[model samples]
Target chain A: MLKNYFKLAIKVLGRRKFFTFVSLFGISFTLMILMLITAFLQTELGSDAPMTEKDNLVYLPAISIKRAVKDTVVERDTSYQEGIMIVDSTVTYPERINSHSRSNPSYYFVNKYGRDVVPAKNYSIYNNSSYDFFLNSKKLTFRALLTDERFWEIYDFSFVEGQAYRKTQVDNGEAIVVLTQKACRQYFGQESGVIGKEVVFEGQTYTVSGVIKDPKSFHVYVNAEAYIPYTNLPPAVLGGTGLMDGFEVVYQAHTPADIPKIKKELEHRANLFEEFRDDYATYNRLEMMSYTFRERYADNLYDEDDDPAQNLKTVQWLLIFLLSLFVILPVLNLVNLNISRIMERSSEIGVRKAFGAHSSNILFQFVFENVILTFIGGLIGFILAIGMIKLINESHVLYETTLGFNFKIFFYSFLICLFFGVLSGLLPAYKMSKVHIVNALKQNQR
Target chain B: MISLQNINKVYRTKTIETLALNEINLEVSEGEFLSIMGPSGCGKSTLLNIIGLIDEPSSGNITIANQTVNGYNSKDMAHFRNEKLGFIFQSFHLINDLSVIDNVELPLLYRKSVSASERRRLAEEALLKVGLKNRMSHFPAQLSGGQKQRVAIARAIVGKPNIILADEPTGNLDSAMGNEIMNILLQLNQEEKTTIVMVTHDESMARKTNRLVRLFDGAQVS
Candidate 1:
């Protein structure tokens, strides 16, 4: 019976070629767009290399401080009856926050509340007034970071040669640097076994401690092309009076469950800063190794205590609303087409009914017919989406990222097919099933 | 055998009430060729539909094959109808999208006990019985009026239902094609012992039936 329905649906759709084309076009185009967006969102927010432990770790994304200062002023007020003048004093303080602070956060704070595990800080090498490097006299300028020695513990950087500079090495303020494989190839013409080589970056001779695969920019904490000591950066860039406030504090949890304790301890320690520095209040953002700046999702994404993926749901929901809107228009179009198409089959329905078909049988037949159509359209859409994704990647429109189909995309496609099938099939099938036998038999004359 | 006790079918609107079947009581015995004759809009087709279980009477007790059917749900009615009744419409009511063989095989497709090959063989036998063996691969649109009606008859008999309910089966055909249809109906009733309830206006066709039932204004007269 299912086979017969499918066979009949194909013939019926083929009978009206133009209608089939229009409906297929609408379905396929909408699905392609949906799939492409989903793939991109996965790249930005999904768990990937270097941040695979993002679900288990948290890092300070950024911080700011806001304060108000009052200045006294005198104003003259005139009161009516006797034309007398009175002097009134008022004080106004406008709120201000310093969004820009020194890149390196205070090491003193980390050493205070910090446990035995990972603690690291990075300075932006992209802001290179401090150092200029000549790579084979090609004058290559690239973004880099100067991080604490334990930065390697928080980030899962896969190395090609040697390993990160040690905590003892960092404590002694040694000039050691880690170079990405890309940087090593450009500077040394080789990627492996360059641990003892000395290279000059930013007017300082630094020993090459490691060579690693370049991290995707999604891992903002470790996306740099090179890393050196904060001590090696000119002292001018590292100047903050009270505790060297400003770089990200990177920490790894002992286990996935330890994230909350670490966050609470960090929050408490941040709150304590108010007691020591009277006028300052703390306002900082966190991006867990388990989460990214882009996909700061709900707390439950990692099955953890706090929501490290902040405001991500709002963005995700907005995307859903837009996709639904796209889906709805095409579904409405398909519904209209289905109505006209099924109207032609009213006599067939009446005949079926007369042959002992229940209303439910008629309903299932119609729904099955439409579901088959939408699923076919969905398959077409999936193929087109894959093609579109390939085209987008080749076009370099979304640079530094390659998008493709995966299990998540495949699952979403399946759901879209079902959603499209049910969404477009219901009203038409219901309408077809409700067809009065008498009227339907009469319509057979046409 | 079938019995309809005190059946009434009313088509009501906001301001008008039209009785299509009025307090009708009927009995169709097994293997009887009963022809219902009436003028247009006189409830002949409505009565046929109700008897076939395609349309429910407003108030009635319908018993088919010695089991009460009034309480049967739509699904139950459908199953009983498939097992015990078949239908032929005035337009032949063939699915134009399907081939004649596929059209003939339609009834058996709903039966879970019948496999695909069995359905094909049964459909082939039915098509041969209707003298459309050579045209089995042709679509309804490709067949002549008489050929289409034969295909429909083949569809009706494919399941070997105990009763065949044909509504103006030959109304759209010429006199020659109509004779061919009447002959087929006569042969099925006389030779195969299939009971038939047909609604028609042709006086000659009515005379050939074992018994004639005439209705006027939604009520049975004779």
Candidate 2:
């Protein structure tokens, strides 16, 4: 029964040359679009990232604080009446000093006995500045890491010429630099040549001890092309006297399953700070790796008032919806075409039915034909999608990002083709199978 | 052998009802050559469709080969048709894309009793019997009208059905070609002793059969 149905189906298809071409063309066209969309989504989700241990890595954004000063004067009349003469008065304020008391004061006053007076000089002071001030301060600059050497153990950054900084390097205050491939090319004209060379940054020269691979992870900040010893942060940064006064502490869990416990522990640690206890306490937030992209780049992406995580989630959803639209429309169009073509074979179906073909047999034959056509189309579409992705990657569309060919995308597109082919063929197959032999034959005769 | 007892077939539409077959009773014995003759729209082809188990009677009992088939479902009827009957149509109804041999082997593909190679051999023998052995590799479109009908006749006999049903099998051919096709049918019945039933509007074609049944307004007249 199966053989007869397939034989008849092939014969009927061969007989109607124009209809077969149209139907196959429609299916192939839809498959191409679906394949392209699958490739794009896969690349966006970091499926092409070369690192084998991506899930274990975490990125931390450093935070700091510094005090800033602004001066203002006010004038007031002592006398109640406007016409009354008022005695003139002048006030003096002392200059600011560090809380450590070892740092020099910007201003001071000497009394008649040659002792410094508290209010002799007219200088105003402010204290208890937050992390943002330190980060933006021009007077003090340092590379402040709130983490230790454990960070290197989590991420596998490739070294072209030299090794990663050792734990002792952090402890001994070694001023070493790890240059990314891009940075190496920019500074020394070659990735290997950058090793042992010195590059000047912020009026200081640091030896490029190693050339590291570019960070391919989507979540990492692109600007962190250089690594400095975490423990070597200057005394001014450690004592809250420099631009790096605030420390953005990050710790990685041993595995993804430990993230929740780690997050809870960090929150408990942040609550112990006294400065974060009052109304200002709401500003303190601890997040996991999932939120790092938003937490780190929120300010640069949107207005300070907008929620960064919400924006990213919205964009992700929009992309998914757009991709689905690109896939579903062509699939539906092909499905309609398939149904119409099947309808045109109603007479052939009736003849087959009269010849002892069961509904299952008929359904199988139709589905088999569709699967064959779709499989061929899928192969062509996959090749086309790969070329398209390569072309788009080389173009300026996604600047600074690479779209590598991904097997997962190809497999996903193939699965999509199979699913849609079966789903689209169902209605037509059912309708074709149920064709009444008598009526169909009579209609054909007419 | 075939028998129909008071069969009625009515076609209904939203605004009209037409009876294509009404109160028909007929029987043809095994090994007999029978012909059904009538004007167009007189239900001659409808009667053949019913006898072939391709159409259902609105109200009646049909018995083929001494077995009642009136209440048989589609699957059972299809089995009955494949095993008990073969059909040749006025248009030949050959799948034009397939070579002549493939077209002849179609019915045997539905039957599980024959292997593919055996069926092919049998189809080749049937085509040889129909004098079209040289044309086995040629597609239906590549054959002349009489040759196409001969291929259709070979296909009908390939399954070794007990009864052969031909509906105006020579209507598309010239008189000489028509006579050639009629001679093939007569030879099959006389030599193979297979039961043959045919429908035609041509009286001379009807007269060639061993027995003639005439129908007017869906009922048998003689």
Candidate 3:
């Protein structure tokens, strides 16, 4: 029975080539956009290689400090009734409330609280900066990630030549750096045998200790061309008094189950800063927050006062709303088109009804036909999305990010096709199914 | 066997009410080939629709094959119709997208018990019976008027239902093709003893049937 429906659906779609094209165009275009977004999100948010242990990792990107300051207001009233100074008064009110500052945590703070107080299997502090240099008489810019030796343990970067710098090299403040494949190609115009070559940046020359694959844009923390030890930075900048700026911290838990314990301990360590500092009397409260990659992404949209976990829900709802809006507009158009298209089949419906088809039978047949149409459109969209992804990658629009399809993306796209198919097809199928047999036959007569 | 008591079908609008089938009382015996003749808009098709269970009368009790179908829900009525009744229409009503064999297989598609091979076999058998076995792969659009009607007849009988209700089955064909279709119906009635009720306008066709019913202006005249 289903085979029969499938065969008929193909023939019917071919009957009106223009209508089929319009419907397919609508369906395929909508699906392509959805697929591209899904691929992007999967790349950015899914636990792919180099960050495979992302579930057990937490980021301490910023430190927020709140202090209350006194604000004085003076008011003078000189309102008189009948030329009399009946209401002449001066008053001053002093209020202390609401002042906050936020920035990346300092290395000093991480050494005091992060390494000793925080509970974690491993911790790494890193800072990102960019430098420009004249290479081959042309100016070029390269982003640098300065970190301790433990940063390598926290992030598993794929090395193409040589190996990461050791703790001894970092501790001795050796002028050594690792370059990404892209940086190596740009500087040496080659991929290998340049590990010991010296590259000059900002009047300082450093020996290349290693070379690695270029990180994609989705690798937020690791997305840089050059990597150097944090000791290379000035001591004054690393030992800032206010613990309110300079470095970002990442902790690796022993297991995913230990994430909550590590977060609790980090929170406890942050709370201790108030008691440990002599300037405790200057602030009303002291608090610090840490988040996983997703929460940190969500936190980017919120202020220091907003809880990222709570805001995550809001962000999710917003995304869902936008996606639904994107999908529903096309669906409404498809529904209208399907109604007109199916109207031409009223005689077939009448004949089916007369031949023992229940309303449900008719409904399934039409919906099935529509699903077949959608699947065909979806297949086209899949091919289009792949082409678009390839084009985007080749165009260098996202820089190093190379978007590609995976099994998960394919599965999600399949689901999207089904969702698009059923949602657009149900109402029209139901409407046509409920059409009275006599009325449908009348439609045939006309 | 089919019975109808006090069957009434009214078409109502904002200010007018038209009676399509008024106080229709009918009974069709098993294996009896009955013909209903009437002028245009005189309720022949309406009565046929009601008898086929495709349209519900405003008020009526219908019993077919010892089962009262008056209170049957849509699903139950559909099942009853599938099991006991077949329909043939004036326009052939063959799905244009489907081949003649597929069209003949339409009624059996709803029968879950009929497997795919069985459906194909039965459809082939029905086409052979209609002398269109050679045109099994031809679609409705490729066939002549006579061939289309034969395909429609093959479809009507493929399920082997006890009662066949045809609405102007030969109205669109010429005298030769119409006589050819009438002969098929006569053969089915005599050989298989399958009860048949057909709506027609030809006096010769009506005379060929075992019984005749005449209606005028939504009422039985004879």
DockQ values per model: 0.55, 0.28, 0.58
> What is candidate 2's lDDT per residue for A1-446, written digit by digit as tens?
45554555576667767766765565566555666565544443442333333333222222212222333444454664578778655554543322211111111100111111121111111111111112124332222222335445545566777876776876676777777786666556676776678866565566777777766544333224566554445465444422222233233445545544544443343333344335233333322222233333443344233344576666656667976776677568667877887776666566566666666666777887777667766777667767776787778476445556667656776787777777777768888788777666555441
- TM-score for candidate 3, residues paired by index: 0.89
Residues B108-159 of candidate 2 have per-residue lDDT tens digits of 8778888988988999999999999998989877889999999989988988
Is model 1 an incorrect, acceptable, medium or high docking prediction?
medium
Task: Please list the residue runs of candidate 1 whose C-alpha ends up more than 4 Å from where it truly belongs after superposition.
Answer: A26-31, A67-141, A160-163, A167-177, A181-211, A238-240, A243-246, A271-310, A323-336, A444-446, B2-6, B23-27, B60-63
Sorting all predicted structures by TM-score, with the top scorer first, yields 3, 1, 2
lDDT of 1 by residue, B1-222 (tens): 989999999999999999999888899999999999999999999999888888888898888889888888878877988898898888788899999999999989778899999999999999999999999999999899999999999999999999999989889999999999999999999999999999999989989999999999999999
The 10 consecutive residues of candidate 2 chain B with the worst lDDT sum are B90-99
TM-score of each: 0.81, 0.77, 0.89
Candidate 3's residue-wise lDDT over A224-330, tens digit each? 88999988988787766657666888889888788888878877776666643575455665556788877877766664435877877777777789877767887
* Shift of residue B55 alpha carbon in model 2, Å: 1.0
Candidate 3 falls in which docking quality class?
medium
User: Over 4 Å off in model 3, which ranges?
Assistant: A69-97, A218-220, A239-245, A256-286, A301-305, B13-15
How accurate locally is residue B68 in candidate 3, as Cα lDDT from 0 to 100? Answer: 87
